[model samples]
Target: MKLESNLPKQSPWLYTAPLLNTILLLLVYFLFTSDFVVQSGISVEHPESNSRLTGFDRAHIITVAAGTDSALYFDGLRISQPELREKLKANREGERRAIIHADKHAPHGRVIEIGNMALDLGYEVAYSTVPPKS
Candidate 1:
């Protein structure tokens, strides 16, 4: 024997509506709560400065990380000063701009040396710095 009910039939979407809404809510929550940092290459704590520089290209970027050993990075790769010099020499064409993202704790002399190298190569050098806190 079989039993039959007189209840109305429900669409399949009725069962999945709650789940879809929950997934959508979770996606929206994560998107709003997440931090989107768009920096590439080695991470470093930039020093704060009151001055601001604008309209500089990032084709050539050198990162000077903290500590004295193996702290130089070019194009996201750890490189030596000599290797950096060679790379800069190779890309001497087009817009000659070198943006240096030096860590606040990095050796000041080393940062200056890198800047000098870029300057000697006839590339306009700019140091990356965070805006001063209010």
Candidate 2:
């Protein structure tokens, strides 16, 4: 005795639908979960310089903002000069280096003061500047 089957063959799309859906879902998931690029640090218009220097491997960043207020930032946090001194003293285990990011419009006296403070703390100081626009 011979037996006959009565099922219809499925289309190629039916076999691929789940895979396509999984790929599309993965794409959407990554698009929604991934972090976008953000510009970090205190905004400052650095003075132009012709010379280029390598950045320190491990250093404290002191940012001096423009305007009459002349706000001071130590390692991205707003801080007073004395507070900065204390913080620097506390973080003296590693290489002692300070990078000053001063705005072009910021007062020269304040920059000098911070530089002096860093020097007093026995830290090698370097000023940050942008390359001259050609």
Candidate 3:
């Protein structure tokens, strides 16, 4: 006796379902775990440099900007030199490091002043520069 089959055979595409699902899951995981550093509100025209940064953590960021007014911004908030000093003094208890994003047009003295303050507060200071042009 011959058996009658009514349902259509499964599509070949079904074979790749597991693989597609696995790839999508991995993509999502990597997207979330990737180190994505968002710069604070201060916009800076960073000076180009051949030097590369290594082992840098941007948890604490300071932005030195120049234009109508030269100012120091900490975590996106405009702050005075004394305020910055106080901040570093308090943060000294924890990680003693800061990533300074100083505008290329900013006064050289201001950048130096900030770095000195950080050093005085016992912080290992790091400067952020744009990658050299190809």
Candidate 4:
């Protein structure tokens, strides 16, 4: 009497299954752990502070970028002062809260002027600050 083979033949894909699974797991781990920073419109060096604040996600962000022109950016768009005034006036109809991110070396007067404009438009302004280095 003839006996059937006990061992099954393995396919090429099965040989690489373990390695594929490990690679897939590592890809997922890095994707989940990598920090995703939402870049505000402009780049600025936020001053260090000891105070902790609440959410700024819902608040409008106004960035004061220091350079030759010292421009203002909102929602990643460079807007003129007149345009900013108009936008703020319109936004005041809704939740009037703003987060100002001014460069550490930016003109204090310009930043103050922007903050005052926000306030006058009924916006509750908050300055963005980073934690002091350890």
Leading candidate by TM-score: 3
**Model 3 misses residue 31 by how many Å?**
3.2
TM-score of each: 0.69, 0.68, 0.81, 0.70
Which tens-of-lDDT digit does each residue in 33-90 have in candidate 1?
Answer: 6754325468899999988776674547799988857388887888999999999889
Candidate 4 error regions (>4 Å): 1-38
Q: RMSD of candidate 2 to the true fold?
A: 6.8
Candidate 3 residue 26 Cα shift, in angstroms, is 4.2
lDDT of 3 at 57: 65
lDDT of 4 at 99: 88
lDDT of 2 by residue, 2-112 (tens): 987898887999989999999999999899867542222899998999876665746778899999989999878999888998998898687798889999999999999
lDDT of each: 0.85, 0.86, 0.85, 0.85
Error of 4 at 129 (Å): 1.0
List residue ranges in candidate 1 displaced over 4 A.
Answer: 1-38
Lowest lDDT sum, 10 consecutive residues, model 2, at: 32-41
Model 4 reaches what TM-score against the true structure? 0.70
Cα RMSDs, all models: 7.1, 6.8, 4.2, 4.8
lDDT by residue for model 4 (37-73), tens: 5468576899999997776657888889887677998
Q: Of 2 and 4, which scores higher on TM-score?
A: 4
